[model samples]
Target: MSDKELTTKKYWEAYYKNSHVNKQHILTVCSYYSPIWEIFISNSEVSKSLIEIGGFPGRYLAYLANRYNIEPTCLDYNSDLTQIEGSFMEMDVQHYHIIKEDFIKFKPKLKYDYVMSNGFIEHFKNYDDILDLHVKYMSENGRLLVMIPNMKGYIQFYKYLVDYKNLKIHNLKCMKLKVFEDFAERHNLSILHLGYYGGFPLGIHQKINFLQKIIYKLHRLVFKYFANDKLKKYPSKYFSSAIVGVFEKQ
Candidate 1:
């Protein structure tokens, strides 16, 4: 499956139907980005408004609400979202709101202090349009946080060579840091930070074969036993599985 096919609602719905992993908890998402969020939120004050695009379940936003006291909002088109065990409606955090609509066409009367998306941009060939929409909702000096699979990184190289069959189902674009730089230039966004970090490996998804599953477990064990905590804070295209960028509107 190409990234195009993988991003379709049909594929994701089917994928979600079979997966029960991190579906119900904000802890997983918050813990994964704790280092990145620490840096991103360091100089900023709490209570800043934030909106997450396509952040279904809204667990991370809920976590932010609890951790930073920031007002949280999420935009998604999942009308049946309440059926999910961990959807936004289930989170206990206060001041968390949901806008159930197509994110591309969503327009709010009030702008946000921060805009975020994880694993979102790589889905569409027209990433510019989607990114521009995120920017349009940001207040002046507002920040944008985007996280995606690192196509140009060493992890991808390993996957291509070792788990080539499993990798094909992901349908991720070969997006490099430069692609984001281009978007920043075109949109009057300044690159505050850009780097790679550890993330969920490809083979853990439900569609992978048994051999890929073994490889995934082995990769997790290696990271658990041998990875350096400090070094993991620094982004390396050659080593990190995920790329993260923090941008500020100029």
Candidate 2:
């Protein structure tokens, strides 16, 4: 409720007001193999009641509606993105519901069978606290899906070369896994699976082709070694470009 939380309203409004990355790329990656595909489709039966935190423009939610036959209302602090679909409500995530407002001002009263946030929390300086927010809303036996910038992704290296705003952690932190796991445990959520992409093991994204079928297969051979038992055993903050956790609330 202080100035710190208040900034989210303006920050996110600017984000949603701007043009996004090419929608085609989103459809190609997310529509195909990302957790977005798995979470959206697997829980399609409960689509009508789903509530997406940080839902922007309803792109992924719309994917669920179109591809998985689920109707989901998206929520964000921005009013503009909610215009076309009418499936949005303006509410801040940290301090919502103070004066009979939306779910953002206070703890969520509605329990969703599935709660998801993708590429949203990583922007926070304190991602640990950000994730705890989601865990608070998770229904018993519900699933929480999160996709952040992968620390080990091919694109991450490029960020160092070309952009100044790349995730600073790789440049700063020793480990990020413990941070993620701690947040999950504090709320009694268990992570089921985690993956790194471009198809895995060998650097699948290295090939200039980007669509070379052979490289994808070779990367399959690569995934097993890179994400070996030892590394995978450690907290997700220890490795990978981004992480996805399928959490079941206890």
TM-score of each: 0.79, 0.61
Runs of candidate 2 exceeding 4 Å displacement: 1-26, 34-36, 39-48, 82-106, 152-157, 166-175, 199-241
TM-score, cand. 1 = 0.79
Evaluated with TM-score, which candidate comes out highest? 1
lDDT of 2 by residue, 1-250 (tens): 3332324566556646755434464466456444435643365355334557777655565555455554454556565643325321221111111112233455676766667777666555555666777766666677777665565445345334333233352222212455557767787777665544322223332224444455445544565555445444443432444565666676
- Give each model's clash number: 2, 17
| lDDT score for residue 13 of model 1 | 56
Candidate 1 weakest ten by summed lDDT: 82-91
Q: Give the per-residue lDDT of model 1 (tens digit) for 52-142.
A: 8877656677776666778888777665464332443445454567788767656677788888998777677667666677778888888
Error of 2 at 208 (Å): 20
Lowest summed lDDT across 10 adjacent residues in model 2 is found at 90-99
Q: What is the lDDT of residue 95 in candidate 2?
A: 16
